[model samples]
Target: MKTFKLNPYRIGFRTIKTAAGMAIGVIIAKQLGVINFSSAAILVVLCVKNTKMKSMQAAWARFASCLMGLIFASLVFELLGYYPVVLGLIVLLFIPATVVIGTQEGVVTACVIILHCFNSKGVSLDFILNEILLIIIGLSIALLLNLFMPNRSRELEDYKTNIEQEFQLILSEFSEALKYVDIKLDHRMIAHVQLTIEKAKSVAFMDVENHFGRNDNSYYHYFTMRGEQALLLYRMVGLINNVSRSDQLHQQLSELIHEMSQNISGHDHTAIRLHDLYAIQLQLKDHQLPTSYEAFHSRASAFQLLHELENYLHIKSKFGSLKK
Candidate 1:
């Protein structure tokens, strides 16, 4: 039998925020004399999502859905008379209404509200007031807690550094592979780069959400450029893997790759890199064509590599301009 090992010290910020929000909501609801204080806690648990924008959106949806449920319950239980059959009818109508209003995220919360009405057997003015107060307490606490998110710009910068480091490593590996055939390439590096880019994009989006008036699209543009570069890098790696021998052309390409890796963090090296890449293209054009099938394939791979290198340089240049 395998024993389950759990890390007791590892808790995420989201978990902490949700827990704090729930405690606060429940306390406030009880102090305000809400009979069903647990509903406030439930709302907190459901409303506190990953990002501030998401949390706010969820809160609004839940509030709307709860209101709809309250209205339906008031009519069904008061007019139709409280019964299990009436509760069934409410569910049948409520589900479609929530879906139509685009508040499906609050479906469970809506059901909870409807259940509260059923338990009371009817919707009294006090019960409706209590439900409204609970909604206010729960959503207010969740929104306030979510607003306390840490500075995500720092996290985005860290992601940028990590992604650049990975790119440098991959480029260095590519340079080495250009010079020798025995060096095995780790194809996983491209996958890692792809994953890091996605994470960076997500963090950047969160950063955007944290600020209300900031119109900076630099992070979004930066991640998009990186994503495009990753695709090019993937193709370059595939092309490099086909080369089996080092000649003057391969040596020059290796030097170019090394230079690129060294300047991965630089701001304005794109022009210089583009110049060098153009020079390499000219050299490849002037070089003698291969006669053997293997040589022809190697030469074709080299051309493809240079083409991708040119594209990568252009993307870097575009990214730098965005920063300015």
Candidate 2:
């Protein structure tokens, strides 16, 4: 079992936004003389999200559901005289109605409106308008705060740089392993890089969500490309591990790998590398046929390793062209 630790100093931007928005929203609502003004803070807390799209979604759902809740509460309470059982009956009907309307995310905010209606002496136009004003005030403040989303480009670039560095190191290590068959490749490094790519993908997705009008997803696609290439690397490691002996082809491939490691980056240089790789392939094909069975196995493994490396380069090539 893992123990949970709470760090007091680790505050997130979303947390700061929620706290500040709550205070500002409630103050504005109170100044506007809206009833249940403090509930404006609750709305702010509920609507604030890590991304602008999500905050907008929550605000819309809350507004739509609260409107429906007002209709339900006004009719039910006005006819039934705001009895406790009647309030219970409203909950039973309101929740399902919210789900039916696809505004279940607003259930809590809508219930707050319903409770306000129940607390009033009677359903009057003034009180209904007041609740509506509160909704507008709360959701407006949330949207306003969300308009200031922190730019994630730098953070995403960092992830990209880190992933490229990891790839460079992995390739360099693989180059060493090719030259010396006894040098065991660390599989964990590949796993860690894949995990980092996944994390970076999620951040990229959130970044896309934050930008309402922008549609470019180059960052997301970049991480996806790296993830695919990481799988190729993992497969190449397995192929390298299977080789029982090193030969001239192994040395050539190692040199190619070292060259690739030096050039590893976000930019596309796949065409040149592919050309070099194919030249090596030709050399292997025309080289003296493996004289022994063990030699044949080693040569076969090298070919398979080259094939995986080719696919890896092709992945980046396609991604680079698409980026352009």
Candidate 3:
């Protein structure tokens, strides 16, 4: 038999925020003298989300559905009589109604409101106002708490640093692989770089979602640029690993890649790199035709590698221009 153990240190900021938000919502609702004041806490629990847009969306859906639910319940229950069967009918009809209106996120909350309506025995303006107040109190507290999410920019920056370092290491390895055919590239490191970029992109996207008013996010753009470069790097790795032997051209490209690896960062060095790449391309054009099939294949791979490198720099160049 396996025993389950909880890692107490696993609690995160969201947990803390939710707990505090629930308490505040309940207290405020009770102070407002609203019936079923604790439902406000439930609303807070349901509405808080990892991103501001999601939280806002949940809150809006819940609020809208709750209102619609109340209206549907008040009419159907008052007219059809508040029987248990009537309650069931309301749940049946109201769910589909909410779905039709695209407020399905609030279906649970709406059901809660329906129960309140059923228990009231009759629908009155005062009763409807009370439910509205409860929703406002709960959802407002949730939105407020969600607004205090910890800044993830620092974490994103750390991911950026890790990704750049990994790229540097990978490129340095590529340079070595060029000079020595027997050198084996670390597939594990390549995998790690891909994983890191994905994680960073996730964080960057979350950062973008956190800012409701901002149309542009630099971190997102940075990760996107890195993601494109990573694809190029993966292709280059395969090409470099297949190179038959080192020659003057191969050595020159290797030296250039080494320099590029040294300068990998958020800064724009694409213009300089592109100039050097063009020089290398020009040199490639001046070389005599390969006499052997292996030499031809190697030269072909070198040309592809050079093209990939040029594209990699162009991606950064475009990104830099956009940033300006």
Q: In model 3, where is the ten-residue run with the lowest total lDDT? A: 315-324
- Residues 1-324, candidate 1, lDDT per residue (tens digit)? 999999678788989998888889889899889989988999999988777878889999999999989988988899998899999999998999889989999989989999999999867899999988888899889999888887776777788889889999999999999988888675689998899899888878877776767756587778888899999998887788876564457888898999999988576777888888888877765777787888888888888888899998888886675462
Instruction: TM-score each candidate.
Output: 0.92, 0.92, 0.92
Q: Per-residue alpha-carbon lDDT of model 2 for 213-283, expressed as tens digits?
A: 98768899889989999999988887887665546687788888898898776345677889999999888
lDDT of 1: 0.85
Clashing pairs in model 1, backbone N/Cα/C closer than 3 A: none
How much lDDT does candidate 3 score?
Answer: 0.87
TM-score of 2: 0.92
Residue 302, candidate 1: C-alpha displacement in angstroms: 0.8
In candidate 1 the C-alpha lDDT for residue 145 amounts to 89
Please state the error at residue 49 of candidate 3 in Å.
1.7
lDDT digits (tens) for residues 1-324 of candidate 3:
999998768788888888998999889989889999999989999998998988999999999999999888999998999899999999998888888989999999989999999898988999999999999999998899889878997898799889889899899999989988789775677778888999888888888889989866898888888888988898887788766664457888898899899888644576788889898887776777888888888888888999999999888887774341
* Residue 216 displacement in candidate 2 (angstroms): 2.8
